[model samples]
Target: MAREGARPAYDPAGHDTALRATLQELRTGRWMSMRRLLTETTAWWQWTRRTQVLATAAAGTDVVRTWLEEEPHSVPATVMHARVCVERALRAHREGHPHTLDLWHEAWRASHTATRAAPPDPVPWVCLMALARLDRERQWAEHRVAPPGPMLPPGPWGLLAEADKRDPYNREAHHRMLQFLYEHGTSGRLAEAAGYAHWAADTAPPGSALHLLPLYVRVERYRRSGGRDAALDLHWVAEDATREAQRALYAWFEQTFTAERSLLDLNHVAHALWGALQFTDATRLFEALGPYWTPQPWAYRTPDQGDTAQAVEIFLQARARCRPA
Candidate 1:
């Protein structure tokens, strides 16, 4: 049987009819086979030659589009295609290759335009990062302007901070609120983050990372001064967040570490989780650090007090000490 979205396999007997129907379909934007329409995997060098030719010939036209649709997950293939197109365009621009930049720019605009027209539902954060960088580069190449940072949604981190001062320990509320804060914070929603933080602090853990996060160093002074309530409050805040937020951090951490390679090398996540008293997730991460340990490195700031390495160590230590249940 013929494939689902393909034209009937060409047959000499029906050549005239097929030709007439295909031509008519083309005029209406109906492709013979969307899957076979643009196969970029024929061979890398050969593919580039064709892409370059198509781009050069179709400069400033919607020749290679289909990718901007946000219906599908942000697959690596889409990212790679965008990168290849951008690289070729930039190279052409730099080398003064005839029509190279124009073709590349055309392709870039087509894809990005498509992205904007129907921005991915989840907004394809990573791929959008790539697009953002590409736009910044292209702009600098022509207009010399840096792209602005991503726009965020509102959150309540500030309010929560104030509330935490009035009542320094409230793990359950903190966990729930922090969950909403972090989730919404991704969209640059500060008001939402602040509201969640306030709610979280309203009834947060007794002593956890949530409380110690903003006061890692200063709180240490309180801990050393026999301020048991303050110290324990800090402890509960960290631990509670870790345990509750384990899945989110776990997904990210597991993406990086493995059983054979304890995150002791980086330690930040582990430490943060440990500070939150999230020994269970930490232990699981330590034990499953096998092939899951991605050789690719990742680094990011956390809570301002400790780095990734500290986070890892703190968690590893916790994992080591926890009695198996």
Candidate 2:
């Protein structure tokens, strides 16, 4: 409920009030609030989400390191230390940093230690999977595991399974796996990734966030294309596209509580529904989103891939299109 005019300013905290506050404190070099927040979070999904966000904030700071220094045996601190390390590695990979190999090894070691320290938690395994992207050459045998089906290429399936054993249909785990596929794909179409996405959504529980997997893959596929082709405009409203949007709508949005929904997932579904021209169905998602919005999905609606200003404008235009009856 930021008061900055009509449009809700983008909130990076993404609907988690506690996470927002804790991120602020961590930015100022305080780890106490983060400790308390994660301590009280018992759900796997929320724990993963909070850790991901907190790790991003802690990546450039010593907050997680400091916390670990004070509480060497703390499982939460260990998990967070792993999370920050993985975040750093992922960021380094994206930037093509020269020391990516060193960071990747450091993150891998930290993540393995976290897996040992917190066996029941999925975040550590997720950490391991997240860094699988840094292994573009698939040097490790874990990165070369055979896929369960014919569609998937060799990947760290064992790491994905370990995380899944802890939390079935974990959103981030699948996302991390998808990231690996995208980075390691041999073709421009990401056929393996598309097949993997559909396979995931096929097995997901109705209420789980994994329902949004195919939607993300669609966005990724769309982005991987030149993204500006007018003919490709039909990509969103095609039979498969609309069906995917509706499947996510019914499977995820309708089955979950408003409070528990991932903000980015909400944005994805709303963007999909709107793009598919299902304005009436999209209306509810827009209302559920309130003022907050993520920029990428909407940015894809524009010709430019990462155009925030145009993205916001398109988001507002779409919101306007799907208002109350």
lDDT of 2 by residue, 65-103 (tens): 999999999999999999999889888888989988899
Instruction: At residue 232, give the lDDT of candidate 2.
Output: 81
The lDDT values for all models are 0.35, 0.88
Model 1: runs farther than 4 Å from truth?
1-78, 83-126, 129-243, 246-273, 278-281, 291-319, 322-325
Quote each prediction's TM-score.
0.29, 0.96
| Model 1: lowest-lDDT 10 consecutive positions | 291-300
Q: Global lDDT for candidate 2? A: 0.88
Model 2 misplaced regions, further than 4 Å? 1-5
